[model samples]
Target: MTKATLQRRPLVKQILANADDNLLVIGGLGSSNWDITEAGDRPLNMPMWGGMGAPVGMGLGLALAQPSRRVLVITGDGDMLMSLGSLATVATQQPDNLAICVLDNEKFGETGNQATHTSPRNNGPTDSGAGTDLAMVARGCGIADTGTVREASQVAQLVKDLRAAKGPIFRLVKVMVEKLEFVMPPQDGAHLKDRFRQALLGHP
Candidate 1:
């Protein structure tokens, strides 16, 4: 079946615009980081500048630590594939407040748009031999609330799921392959950590 065409910027904007102050967002490296920054930077938004596949684990820890708050991890297919084992760990921990959204463009956007495993074979020069279904992988890892969002109409429910679903929820959003200018947040890791800490804990 052919996939629906959806842009990353608008979808990301819609999702983050509805987020309440209690939502703690962690953006994985590369385009995911830039996408969140384009949405608008907040103290609660932690855009990882270096970590490749660490967002899920980090977000899980945050969700476990702050049981009252919602933790959203937005990452790419390449990043998620790099640490597939983390999905099982998250399922084992079962943090009810944690949700993960993978922006599956099927390419390693930061690394010259190389195809990831999720890319369909023969689709292009960068296509993979077997396109991985990430939502299925998450479900196999014991996350029952898993889905793939390929339509713009589903964005509302996805946003709701991220905020209120009985998590750890996992969603694979198939975004269009587009070249966009980078919208960066604060690059200093310490400053980003301090701001996020202050916003969530009232301490630097």
Candidate 2:
């Protein structure tokens, strides 16, 4: 996204500015980019653990935990597909203020471009992505509203609209490829964790 656009738009900035202690990011392996990782005031990237598709569930839990605040999820297409069933749960609960931002690169950057359901060009089974319409999936899951965005400039505004939302909305940002790859040292766990904590303070 940052790559194709040539600039870091307001993906996390808008959310953080509007955040009233109610937003958490669940980034997939591909989400380790500094733009998304360090952007949120309360930024959160799910650990490189299995069940990559579970971030929505975690976001849902937070929304359910504190209904008064808004909750946003910055996840990838591959991560969201692992537990697609959870979307039904999200729809079933229909928690207001739960907005999910899916950066649909069509490939899983985390696992060396593992094909996600939303992949536009699937080479084979292993490289084949879901090839499904994620926006439609979100609609089927009972999202309040959904759209596919191409330009990076729309990111901030899209998130702002979601923040003001009264129901669960989803935005599918169609990015060509990852603009940048984050290179973290092997064992910076403790230090990086603290850095992430500080990143959260930048949010509203």
Candidate 3:
């Protein structure tokens, strides 16, 4: 089936609009970081600036530590692909409060838009073979609540699943490739950590 065209900013805004104080969001570096900040800068949101594949692992740890809070990891496809094995580990641990959403533009947006494994390739030198199906990989790793979101119509359900699905859930959201201006959050790592810690734990 052909994928629907969706913009990352609106989709992210819609998802976060429904979120509450109990939602602990961990954003992957680069575009994912900007997207979440664009949605809204909250004390509960932790946007990583350097860690490439750390969001999922960090979200898992946070979820395990705070079982009552819903942990959402927002990352790019390239970042998620780098830590593919972490999916298996997440499945093994089966943290019910954790969910992962990959904003898959199918290219390495941060590094000169290089085609990632998730990018579709034809028979040519540039081909990296067929595009990787991340939702399938997540399901194969025992995440039963997994899906790909390519339509605006799917956004509502995606938000609902992120909030209430039996996790560790995974979703691959196909977003458009656009050069939007960066919407940055506070870049101070220590400050971000202190703010998020204070919001979630009531103390920095």
Which pairs of residues have clashing backbones in candidate 2? 41-200, 41-203, 53-79, 115-129, 116-129, 116-130, 117-130, 117-131
Candidate 3 global lDDT: 0.91
TM-score of 2: 0.72
- Estimate the Cα RMSD of every predicted model relative to the unseen true structure: 2.4, 5.6, 1.7
Question: Between prediction 2 and prediction 3, which has the larger TM-score?
Answer: 3
lDDT of 1 by residue, 45-159 (tens): 9999889989999999999999999999999999999999999999999999999999999899988998898887877576655688999999999998999999878999998
Residue 98: error of model 3 in Å? 0.9
- Displacement of residue 174 (Cα, Å) in model 1 is 0.4
For every model shown, the clashing-pair count is 0, 8, 0
Residue-pair clashes, model 2: 8
> What local distance difference test score does each model get?
0.92, 0.64, 0.91
